[model samples]
Target: MPRLVIVFDEFAEFKGRHPEESKRLIGIARQGRSLGVHLILATQNIEAAVDPEILQNSTFRICLRVGQAQDSLQMIGIPDAVNLARGRAYFRAQARQQFQGAYCGGPHGKRGESVSPRGIIWVRRDGARREINLPGWADGRGHGEPEPPQYTEAQAIVERIQQAARYLRIRRPALVWPDPLPPRLHLPEILARHFQGGWDGARWSVCRPLRAQARQIAEIQPLIGMCDDPARQQQVLLQLDPERGGHNLLMFGSAGTGKSTLLRTLVSAIAHTRSPDSAHIYVLDFGGSSALKPLESFPHVGAVVTRFEDERVVRLIRFIQDEVSRRDALLRREAVDNYRDLNARRAPSERLPAIFLIIDGFGEFKRLAPAELVRSVGALLGGGVAVGLHVIVSANLQADVPNAIFANIGLRLTFSQADQSEYFRIVGRPSEARLRQDIESPPPPGRGLLRGTPPLEFQAALPSRGDSDEEQATQLSLAAQAMSAAWKGPRPPKIRALPFLVTPTAMVEAAQSVAQTDRADLLVPLGLDFDTLTPLAVDLAEDGPGFLVAGTGPQSGKTTLLRTWVLGLGAQPSHDRLHFLFLDFHTRTLAAFRRLPHQNAYVGSAAGLDKALAALDEEVARRKAQLESMYEAADGDFDSGQVIRGWPHIMVVV
Candidate 1:
């Protein structure tokens, strides 16, 4: 099974809120290996705060981009996300890149740029950003047409973003920086020489000219069958056409085949460049890491909107739907209905920018989201072009990659993979990555597949350990010693048992409150509440790797019900109680949680939502353990102190 880099930047905080959804995601993730799915999430905040049942089998945590003391308390068990500036991002994959500013790019602003709270941007090996002034696209309106594209309130912000992209590039070099940065970019040999590389004793960085995939391994030989041939990596780059081909492509490969490196190079090369027009570059991140943070600085994205739940993704899709409508209106205003009409309206402030939306870990969003997977895929495959919304999806397995991604996608790429089935699944034919016989088994750190206009067939190797290293490290088995090493901070406190306190009345009350508030923090979620919601929280208290779903209906009171449980547990007061958190989906729930006292931390659709289910599983295990510790059978009142058997616990649902 190909190991996946599951980013749970806020799993510990939000897992309990949507227990059902979490469990469902985990179940799929657990079965992912056979199905080709990898699940990863952050657990620093809830390790001790939650019952063992919630995380029955989970025992790992990656801490990156920690907040302040309280925030760090949730990540790496050290409160880091707060201390770091906007640039920093952390990860459980210590083997990968963990710096900020290095990857996270600043936002596109009136002055220059600023860093975004979430999402990773790639760096340009070309050095500083170069501004370019280019002709703008018409806004789907004819010059003679009396009507014009609506500057509606919602579109106002988007228009501003469009304006910023144009303004930023006015004075820069055309390709002086970079273009086609989204949907899988590749840095040619000129860029990879910056960082230093080392394995065991051998290491190299970009400063040095990288020979054509140096024939042999130098310092590090971390993963087995890793290919380090710079030439082979370069050969793959040769196949890419950043300018054309699959705007939304897939690269399938086994671990150590250099897929990560290629991805890193792609991102880096994009950093130095800016899209000449709108619909340039945008990313809907499912993975909660800073790998793509650098994109924030690119001229493409006017603003970054980080979404953490399926609902948010859906909302974005809906927004896209609305945007398509807006464009249609623009066309009617100009008496033209196609790109040509929009071209006629192409003026400095008249046209809408082209957007290339890149989404990593396409499966994570589907794991627990209510949106139909096929429908979302169809939107991207069919209407995405009309709305100027392009997609680039990544998944550990070909199945997770989704049919829509491959069906309508014009381009395809595959990383090194021995499994021909996975390769064929992604590219429609036996994958070259799976059949790549000339390359070594382990194709270096960043070696993999990249398909574009020219079509690449080699691997990508960054001199210094690049983002690929971090991505590759995420695949290593958790059983490894390093997978769960204690952080550099104080020792993690012991976990305590938390009892369930949601009553039917509470569920109803929460639902009733939904009309007033989103019912964000209480258990029994404002909309969803049933026996399984409460009983299960208690049952999985002892580390059972459980995952829950809010069921089909809108998780109305679910967020509220979870808040109730969190508040109930937090009432006990202790670092142990502090361990659990409600990972906020991409919704206002986090804000609500923040306003309420006793919240361990608020994770609002900013991180780890793509794999929210994994976090739920960890909580389930804690619940399971607690339940098991109690009497052989059912125990009377399961509370914070009176353990049925003797264990820590907390209930979560959505």
Candidate 2:
């Protein structure tokens, strides 16, 4: 018990007489914490006798009636210890305190007549008290030591461990297996003991037991399905290990052969077997299947693209390609061989997960995806594996999957392809159509053949789903909420909003407001720019060149643009400050502004255009002469000054 104390009254005298005794006491002090030994050493010469190591590890220290101030300071780090009165001590342990002992009883006091330390008239609490020996003053008193504590099973075990000096620490060496013997010493018990035969079971028909020792080794990658090998049972797994080849995979099968289901199963396996750190799935549901929808809720999944729009797919592919390039540059800069090495060395925030691109319905995707997307997909398949990019493509027809992509694909899974040429192209073996004559019906869904040294048959497992889309969506949303709540990493990059669409009318209204102010000089407001949604304006005098609005077809906002400029300029309060000459090949376009007072002239056809041109040329010459006369008279450049009379800025539109 920690309360039990073993006191040594004169440790300095004993140590001075026997030096080995002091060494033994020091050793016990060092190891006695683990054991149940508590030592209380009282000495007059503490600095000369006590070891520094013993003092350092001591939990409790008491300074009582030290003779010298320096001795008190050395013992308890304070000179106040020398001022301690008789029978008074300064106690220091977890905290410091000054303690005064309570008076037990006077020397001449008798049992029931004497006051106890707590000032209580002494009366034994125990009904049955024995005559225990105390100091001669209280000899007649029945004083007994408190009974030793009764320990529970757990406390007894702890006490037993604490009391022991040193425990027997066992350090076992690694077990090494010996070579198996030949079949001449046939022993089924040895094989059963080693393998614990179940999935590792295989018949050794005429084999030597030395070469046929069963070993239970788990599949490294997640199991896709169980291979149908007659001799031995093995699982078909999808692996992204570079040593096994690139991670890209291709699946070709006809309709209703579970190609889509297999993809869903693969995604489910990936989500379960690998953590979010290991893999990030992106499901491109080209055929618009709800199978991939549930995966959107998985923390490991980045997105599920159900829309088959070409532009959206193009953008997504470009984003992935850019990411690939970024990772490549990072790897090159870090001098790493692969993504795994780079990820291990990089900081947690900078680390990249293996990106698995699961694309379903290759035929449908090809029909809608642009050329850029196709090229990006090819590049990802060919080069992205080294940078932790894995692709799984599922196609209904063999021809739909590009032959060029076949070179990069590591694994090819085929299911019920009716065409022999398609089967041959995918599996690289001639199909045995006549052999299937024994079967009357079609192969079941998810039943497929894996192409290898010797082709293996397997059944792909499908992930469980909710009964209805609403339930599935609810479950997904709830799961996503939970995942987001649990996530502690750096937040994902914020999604940028597409440029806000600005209508032509809004632009015209803005321009009209600008025209009301004097600061609006030659402001021809075109509709918002496609890239930035900001007002696309051209200051004819400040910004060089004139407006050229071109498009492939009619009513493509070209005419609307010209009308906005004309209306905005005409809306100006100072009508003579800016002039407008409207010329239209198709005269109906500028009909909205025909009645406006700001018009210099409205011309249509070649003859009207010639007349308008002649008028504008004469006006320019007249303005030039007026400006020259003003310059000579004023001896200053009047062109740089405010608007001159009858020399307005002209805006011509065709």
Candidate 3:
């Protein structure tokens, strides 16, 4: 077996933190010499400070740059070692010897050829001596430019670093400089050559599962992913306050870039970190286009609003507003600044949980939602930070979101964008790091750029759909079962139904009993008024005057209005009292009224319309003649109010 030489730097400081490890090191020091193993320990003080065994087992002693005479005496058995100049040291195994160390070049004295204490001449392979030229003479040239100044080993390393930075600059690059460039960055010739092979190795590998990896490290904070910084090797934790970063998140990416997946990972991390009683998630996945459906089943979820519809969006916005107000009042009552403080002081039931609103995509929201929703979102973004309310929205592109909403976002994660301009919009600059041209062609899913003091490249985590086929099909199976089960049982009435939208059936049920009208009058109720939302009943006389109804389009409730009017009059008193006429010029407009007993005429085509009109004219003439006869019978007086008392009201609707 090959021998191993272990070198410990600053052993005294290391021993202070790890006493048990120090003891083990001493044991290894004592026995490793027999097993072809050795320890080369360096420290500002003697190893005895950590444990005396390390000092007793050491085979040789070297004293250099000693600050005290006693340390020099202990190591080299000399008193004059403290006064020694640079590049000079005393070595002792059995007999001590003093020597001047030669400078072998490079910042750390690791590279370049070793030289004797005194310079030596070199002999060529051809048996000739190679002599050094003086500064004044160069290649027998009178000009003597001196071969254009060669850089030292240290300078060459810096030049390589400078060039490496230029080549590694991404379109949207975040440059982080350690306050003092670390000694490791002072690369040797081999390491400097390695940087020439492109690929800075700065980006972190993807986190397969964020939970297990985080738990393995005993991480308690909300860790989204590991940082790409090879030097620091840190986990990118989300900062909930303004000090580290900001709470609100705004993510932008092109389609299929795993924006939704990243969102789920972040939300899952937060859920895993906080209890259900402390944090509640409200997911607004408009259109339900992703794997976010799984999060709905988590107990920490307060509500998962899916289906991209105007009413649903409106309802969610209103709910957020109500919740904000409720929390505000509770905070005031408890004399607390925010939900975190309130929870600390109030009872568990009274405490409010932190609300996380994660909106996956805003395309549907922008198109279908009203302006009020946008305003409400803006208010939440601006003021909800301290109140323990946070919003995380993912959009296909930054342009899809409103400026007001994006402005309040504290943290931003950007994946691949459509074009250069979009990338510029996301990173606030250009970047050569094209997701398409990534080493993992098409860039592995969930790869993104997170902005911070020094931006990071992150690979978001995707949770497993469990291990078995049963787990893989859970979402699909639940959805299929819900379809059949929805109508299988009656839903109990909600304790508090939304006031904005009342069911048509409920509206009809709530209307007062029809009022009995005079013999010649018609009382037909149209639906509730659009503006007032109050019952609207139109009064009409069957004798002469008529009403004309108009509507904008299909959803103008014209069909409902016609149905309500016809159905209302049919149910009151008797069909004989009020007759109805339906002219279905559009074929099916009046089709539903065909079976009503109150209908005197239901004309559809031109021929039917002509026949109905002729019948109506004849009826009017008959009524006039009957009225004249009755007036003549009442002594021919102009006061014919009592003449038509027995005549039936002819209601003609053509």
Count clashes in each candidate, considering only residues at least 3 apart in sequence or on different chains: 204, 0, 6
Q: Considering lDDT, where higher is better, how would the candidates rank from best to worst?
A: 2, 3, 1
Candidate 3 off by > 4 Å: 1-223, 237-243, 287-294, 428-440, 465-654
Give stretches of model 1 more than 4 Å off.
Answer: 1-244, 255-271, 275-281, 288-290, 293-311, 335-341, 428-440, 450-456, 460-654
**Model 2: residues with Cα > 4 Å off, grouped in runs:** 1-242, 268-284, 288-308, 333-335, 367-376, 419-444, 465-543, 562-654
TM accuracy, model 2: 0.46
For all candidates in order, the CA lDDT equals 0.44, 0.61, 0.58
**Model 3: lDDT of residue 24:** 90
After superposition of all CA atoms, the RMSD between model 1 and the true structure is 36.7
Error of 2 at 267 (Å): 3.8
Q: For candidate 1, lDDT tens digit of each residue in 1-654?
A: 334545455664556555666667667766664665566664556453344443443444444554346555544454555655565665432333345434313333332222122222344433345543222323321233322244333453354345545545544222322221122322322333322331111221223224544443221111111122232332122322323453455555554454434443443333222122323455556555535544444333433334344444554555555666677677677776464347656774455654455565556656745556446656655664544444656656776655655666766656655665655455445334335443445443444444432333444434233245454333221211221231122221111122245465754554444332221222223223231222222213333347553645675566555565544444433324334455656556645545444424445674656565566677678776766676456567546446432333343333
Q: How far is candidate 3 from the true structure (C-alpha RMSD, Å)?
A: 20.9
Best by TM-score: 2
Candidates in order: C-alpha RMSD to true structure: 36.7, 30.2, 20.9
Global Cα lDDT for candidate 2: 0.61
lDDT winner, 1 or 2: 2
Please provide TM-scores, in order, for all candidate models, with all chains considered together. 0.34, 0.46, 0.42
Candidate 2 structure quality by residue, lDDT tens digits, 101-143: 5443334333224323211233233324445322321322222
